[model samples]
Target: MTVRPILETHSPSSDPSWWGAILLGAVFILAGLIVLGDVVAATVISAFIIGIVLLVAGASEVFQSFSAPHWRGFLLRLLVGLLYAVCGLMLVSNPAAASVALTLVFALALIASGVVRIVQAVEYWQWFGWLLLVSGIVGIAAGLVILSKWPVSGLWVLGLVVGIDLLLHGFWWITLGAGLRRDNRAITA
Candidate 1:
């Protein structure tokens, strides 16, 4: 059996479908801009959505446990599901508080990651270690800045991160589309 590569049979530029990627990228960029415009609102909305997802997941887990009552772990699963539901309810009830708690955890994780990166960089100090060290420093600095702002930073950090992510994703899609178009042109020529 032989596997055929799709690209070998058809050029990306030959198909007009790549245009959709560019269009989607534009939409993502627009959404990202909107999210960035109101960090507080974005954070709250994000938390609410997460809470809803958790609620749904918890309900599903509980239902699954009940359906298979003979399973040895049924009691444990039910308890875990209940815990998830309670936590989800808490978040939905007060997204602002949930954001604060989540942000603190994020900041702490960033700091820990930076520390680990710095330590790892020591093994390659003669090569690209400097780059790693710089990245670690930046991470630590960012984490410290967020921590300094504390609860206030919580309101905006998650939203800012999400907006930046959307912008980067949009750029990636646009770049991919451009590359595909270029490849198509090259193939035709």
Candidate 2:
């Protein structure tokens, strides 16, 4: 039996266009940081912003659902939109409560995302099951930690975490944006 080498093809050496993506990522990281800072400075302000965002998003969803061609899907979306609106209203009505609510929401989302990722990994790459499982476990652990520190933790830790995340995201975006710009130039060239 002869061992065969895996042959790979490479494009001619040219400037890689990944710079734009990097720059974009950096910008996002920076934006995340800014948002995190805002959250830290005033949780109320952050809550207000979140409320406004939710309101806008919910309204958009409702409008889209109404305009959708599929009535059944539209109805479902409308229900979701209503829920979003209610949550947004609650946040606005009592910004102080937003911290706890946000924490719970974040934890739930993390766990849900982790589960989805794990499932996808299991289906697509059995060999990667461990990776996905670990990710899911981490997400669940994080959620549990957040839940344990709710209220008081929601007030201080949440803001700090959000700020750090924002900072990281902004940096990521900036890097991605720059990379994209570079790639666009290279493509044009």
Best-fitting candidate, scored by TM-score? 1
- What TM-score do all the candidates reach, one by one? 0.70, 0.53
Model 1 earns a TM-score of: 0.70
Clash-forming residue pairs, model 1: none
lDDT of 1: 0.75
- List model 1 lDDT by residue over 69-144, tens digit each: 9999999999989888887888799998899987887678777877876886676454345545665676677678
Candidate 2 lDDT over 80-163, as tens digits, reads 898888888888888777867777777677667667756754663433345445555666666667777776666655565555
RMSD to the hidden true structure, all candidates: 7.2, 8.7
What is the lDDT of every predicted structure here?
Answer: 0.75, 0.62
